[model samples]
Target: MTAEPALRLVDAAHPAASAEGVAPAREQERPETAGAQTLRRGLAVLRLLTRVGPGGLRMGEIGHRLGLNKTTAIRLTRTLVDEGFVLHDRAAGRYRLGPEAFAVGLAAEPSYELQRQAAGMLRALAAESGDTVFFTVLHGHESICLSRDEGDFPIRNQLIKPGDRWPLGVGAGSCAILAALPDDVVADVLARNAALRAEKFPRCTDASVLSLVRDTRERGYCLQPGMVFEDSWAIGVVVYDANEAPVASISIAALRSRLGPARSAMLGNRLMQASKELTAQLKA
Candidate 1:
C-alpha cells in the first residue's frame, strides 16, 4: 500500500481515451421504434390525400381509408396542417393539398422517368389507333392519370389530365390495375369502393363491381362501356414491370358507337402491343 517503490512507468501505452477533450466511447444509437415508424405512416397519409386530389378527404374518410381511428386521423391531419403538407378548409369542412406538398411533388416528378418515357409510346399508340389513349398509375385506392394523348378522330373522349384520380373499380383503367393486384388487396379495394360508390354513384353495386374485376382478370384486360362517361367506351391493358407486377395501365377511350366487335378487337391488339413495348422500355 505504501506506493511500493513507485511502480515503474512504461513508454509503451494505449491510445488516449479522449480525442480533442471529447470521450471517444459513447452509447450506440438505436434504430427507430414503433413511435418513430409512425412518421412513415404520416407521410403515407399525406400521399393518400394528394392521390385523392385537390378535394382532399375528410377526417373520417381518411381514417376509413387508412384503417385508422377518427382520433388518429384528426391527430395526423393536425400534424400535417401544422407542417404545411395539408390545408384544412373550415368553410367547406374539407381538406385540400397544401402548397408545400405541391412544391415537393413538382420536385419529384422528373424522378419518375417512366411517365416521361411512356409519353412517346402513348402518343404513338394514339396516332396509330385514332383513339384517345391514357397512361395511368395506381395511387392509394385510385388510378391517377400520368400522361395522355389525343386521337385524330373527329369525336373522341376528352383527355384526363395528369393527377386526375378515379376510383379503383370504376372504369376500365382502374379495373385493369385492380384485377392485377393480389386477391385480398382487390377485395379490400372493392369493399372500400363499394361504400364510397353507394354515397356517390348509388346505381353501381358491389356485385357489379366485383363482376367487372373478375371479367378483367379473365380477359387479361378490361372493357367498360359507358361506365365513366356517357357514350364512352374504354379498353385497358396492364403494363407490367420486370417482375411482372402491374405498375401502370394503358387505356384507349373512344365513342361507344365506334366500338363494335371488329373495332374493339383492333384496339385491344394495339393497346396490348403498346403496353408490352412500354413495359419493356421501363425494364430497360
Candidate 2:
C-alpha cells in the first residue's frame, strides 16, 4: 500500500479526526452507583461533624449516629482525614472538620453575600425590636444557628446562639424554614424527625407541628410561642435563596413578658420586612 494515498483516504473518510482536541460532554450521573454511594457517605460524615460543633464526635459515636460498623467507619474516617476533609485527634479520639472542609464551605461565594446581608438585617432587627435576632440555616432535618445579634433587651433569650442547632420544628427560624417548605416536604420532615423530637424535645407534638405549619402558612410568617420553653417566644420569616428555596431563616426571640400580643405583632412585622429585604438581596 502507498502510505501517502492511505493517509489521504483515511483523512477524507474521517474529516473531523484532526479536531480530536474537542472534549466530549460528561456522562449523566446515575443514582445507585458505587461512586455515588461513596460520595453520599463521605458527605454524611462531613455533615455529622458540622452538626456536632467544635467538640466533634468520637469514632464510636459517629458510627452509632450514621449506622456504620466500627471497621467501615474507620475506613471512611481515614479516607476523610487523608484528604484533609476531616481532622482526627490522636489523644481525644475525636473527629472534627478540617480546614479543607471550611475552604470548601467558604468557597460558596453566594453564602458569603447572604451572610453579609443577614448580618446587617439581624443587627437592624435586633436594634429595632430590642430582641435577640438569630440567623439560622437548614441542614438536613435540623437548623443550625449561623449567627445572632443581641439588642439591648434587659433579658435576652438564652435559647439559640451561634453554633447551636435544633431540629426543624424546634426553634423559630427552624420552624419558619420548615413551615415555608412545600406541604409534602413538611410532612416528610416531621415524619423523619419524629423519633428525634420524642427523644430530645418531648414537648413538641405532631399536632403542634401541624399547627405551626398551618399558622405559618396562614399568617405568612413563623411563630413559636413558648414552644421550646415556657415564658419564651419567637417569631420569624423565611428567607429564600437565588434558587427561590427556603435555605435559611431569621427570627427574633424574646421573653414572653416582653413579647406579648402587641409586641409580637410589631416585631413580626419587622422580622418579615428584614426577611424580605434579605431574600431580595440573596436572590438578586
Candidate 3:
C-alpha cells in the first residue's frame, strides 16, 4: 500500500507453495530482453495506475513518472488497452486501471476468503462496542484497509475507507500489526519508515513506537491516543497467519470520551477475541 504490492496468501497446500510452503507471486521476473523490458514497463504503468487511486493518470503524467517519452508511453499504453489491462478515456486522455487488473486481484485466493470471513467479525464487534471497526492487512510496509463497519453510535469517527493505505505504524490497525511483527521486521519497518514518520507522524516517535511494540508483546494489543485521526482514540489487536506471523489487524475507533479506560479494555478484549476467530478462519 505504501507503493508496495499488497500481501496475498494461499492455503498451506496451495499449488504455488514451494517446499517451504509460500505462494507464488503474482508478479514474477522474466529474463532480461527487449520484450521482457516492455512487459515490465507495462506492468509498472498498471501499478502506477493503482496507486493514483480511482481517477487514474493522464498519459503525460504517467510518461513523466515512468521516465518514458510521450511516444513510448502511448505505445505501451496502447498495448495495455488492447489487452484490457488498462482503460483509455478518449475525452480526458486519462488511463485508468481496468477490469482485467481487478480480475487478477480477485484471482488471489486467500485474500477474498479473509475478506468474507472478517466482515462478519467486524460487524459483530462493532455492534457490541457501538464504535467503528476496521480490518486492515499489513501490505508491504503499509497497512491497507479491507473493510469497515459502523456501529449504532451516531458520532462515528471515520478517517479511512476500504482501500485506504497508510504507512505501518500510522494508524491503530497499522500500529497493531507493526507492534505484533517479529522483532526483526519491526526494526526493519521502523528504519524504513523513520524519515516518513518524522516528517508526517509527529505523534509517534521512534521511542514511543518501540514502547508500543513492547506493550503489545506483553499485553497482546495496542492502545494509541490521537495518533491517526485527531480526537479519535483507538485500540487494536493483531491477527496472525497459520504460521503465527502477523498478517493483519482488527481495531475499534471512537471518541475519547466514549473509549474511557474501562470501555477501552472491554473493547480491546472484544477485538482480541474477534482477532482469534479471524485468524482461525484465515488459516482454514
Candidate 4:
C-alpha cells in the first residue's frame, strides 16, 4: 500500500498545487454561458430602469449607457417587453418598468417594510423641521434613498431623491450608517468602496470620512457640512435593528444657512429621537 500511490493530475501552472501531486483548491472562473450572459444583461436593464425613475430611457440611450450595440439592446429589450417585465411607450419611444415589474417588486416588499413603517415619521419630521427629510437604507456597501418628504421651506436641497444611490459615508444619513459600524468593519467597507468613491465622489477621502465618523460618534449624530454641495447641509441619525445593528438612517437636508451650529444640533437631536422610535417600532 505504501508502494502504490494513486495517480493524480495537477496543472503545473497552478501555484496552489502541492508538491505531492494534490490538485489546487481553486481554479480560474469560467466565462459565463451565453444564456447566463443574456440573463445578466436583462437584469442590468431592469436595474437601470429602477434608477432612472418614471420617465424611463429611450432604446438608444439604454444601448449607449450600457455599451451595447443597437441590435443587441433591441433584442434584449424586446425580449423583456414580450415577457411583460418592461413596457414600451409607443408615443414616447421609451421603455419603462411594467406591471409585471411592480408585481415582482411586491413579492419582495417584506424586506423593505421599513419604508412603510417610517413613512409617517419622515413626513412628520419634515414638517417639524421645515426641511427635506429622507429615509435611507444600507444596501450592501452603499446607501440608497428609499423615501423622501419635503417641507414648506421655500428653498429645497434637491441633490438627492428617492432611488438615488451613493457610496457609504458620502451623505449625512449614509455617514451615520457608516459611523454606526464596528471599526474593523468600517475599515473593510472603506477598502472595498475606495475605488468607487474616488471615481464617483472625489471629495470623500478616507481621512475626512473617518473624521466624520468620530464626530458622529461623539455628537450622537452626523453632520454633512456642505461637502457634496456648497449650499446643501444635512443632519442624520442611525436606525438600528432589534439586535442594535445599524440598518438604516433618517436625515434632514436644508440650506447651509438653515443648518447653523445651533439649529444643526437641534435637528440632530430630533433625528436621534426619530431613530430610536423607528428602531423600537421595527423591533415590535
Best TM-score among the predictions, by candidate number: 4
Per-candidate TM-score against the hidden true structure: 0.63, 0.65, 0.69, 0.82
Model 3 lowest lDDT segment of ten: 18-27
TM-score of 1: 0.63
lDDT of 3 by residue, 84-128 (tens): 989998888799988898899878755556667788778888898
- In Å, residue 280's CA in model 1 sits off its true spot by 1.5
lDDT string, candidate 2, 52-165, tens digits: 578889999988988898997888999999999999998998999998998998787565567777787678777887777888888888787778787776555545546566
Global Cα lDDT for candidate 3: 0.75
lDDT of 1: 0.72
Mark the 10 consecutive residues where model 2 has the least summed lDDT: 1-10
lDDT of 1 at 50: 60
Give the alpha carbon lDDT tens digit for every residue of 125-144 in model 4.
98898788988898888788
Ranking by TM-score: 4, 3, 2, 1
Assess the local accuracy of residue 281 in candidate 4 as a C-alpha lDDT between 0 and 100.
Answer: 94
- Between prediction 2 and prediction 3, the one with superior lDDT is 3
Instruction: Please report how far candidate 3 places residue 220 from its true position, in Å.
Output: 1.9
Which pairs of residues clash in candidate 4, taking residues 3 or more apart in a chain or in different chains? none
Off by over 4 Å in 2: 1-105, 108-112
